[model samples]
Target: MKGATMKTTMEKLGIIASYSRPRVSNDNPFSEALFRTCKYRPDWPTKGFATKDDAQAWVKSFTGWYNEEHLHSAIRFVTPAARHAGHDRATLANRASLYANARSQNPERWSGKTRNWQPAGAVWLNPETEISAPEIRDAA
Candidate 1:
């Protein structure tokens, strides 16, 4: 089918073509987050990438830092690499203990409770909402 004919057929079938937002927002929250972090990195080039190899090398370095060095707030301030390696639990526990000890020695320094170091259970771009099943009607 040609462009116009296909569009008309899609319209009849209640199908709509997505035009805008090509690569800007791909609906992956995780990717969007990583992209935001990558853009904000201090080493992000002010000018565009010079060459394909330069871009690839930059991406590789950024990936290394993002996964191994950067502490992610969503995952209880643990690096993705640490979390993947099953080290986040111990890291968070150590943080909780440190915070507690600090607060005990300097109670006046803290106005509120210490930050929660508990592991973030699950990550979701859009959490699911409750849905009810459609009612069935008898047909004669």
Candidate 2:
């Protein structure tokens, strides 16, 4: 594997590879999480690979989807690109404003900024876990 060759070359050049103690798995938690996500994705090949090219292609596609369309519930139910591009903030704020009005109005009608807001009846029960009501106070 390329890993062995690289390690060997670095060792030959007196480049010491420093790593955390083996017992401390949390030292590379992010790396561990990425590998876990990649391996457990729904589209991953069930029977493993027949060729290096195939595996590489799958990895490329997976990385693109992961960085593009995948909704990370942990990050306000948006993809990384949307968050990085600033759309996520706007989206969250708009939704929160609508919901805040819905909440403040005591269920008479969807009378917030989204005038077209229908009850969607029980659909918002779970609601957005990430969004918070804006700091602005309700109108008197």
Instruction: Give TM per candidate.
Output: 0.69, 0.56
Q: Compose the digit string of candidate 2's lDDT tens values, residues 11-99.
A: 55544344666659545566777888988998888899889999999999998999798987666666788777767777777776867
lDDT (0 to 1) per candidate: 0.78, 0.65
Q: In model 2, which range of ten residues has the least summed lDDT?
A: 131-140
Candidate 1: worst-modelled 10 consecutive residues by lDDT: 131-140
Clashes of 2: 0
> Which residue pairs come into collision in candidate 2?
none
lDDT by residue for model 1 over 27-128, one digit each (tens)? 455667778888899999989799999999999999899899999888988999999888999999999999999999999999999999987787754446
- For model 1 the local lDDT of residue 13 reads 56
Residue pairs of candidate 1 with colliding backbone atoms: none
- The parts of candidate 2 lying over 4 Å away from their true place are 1-18, 105-140
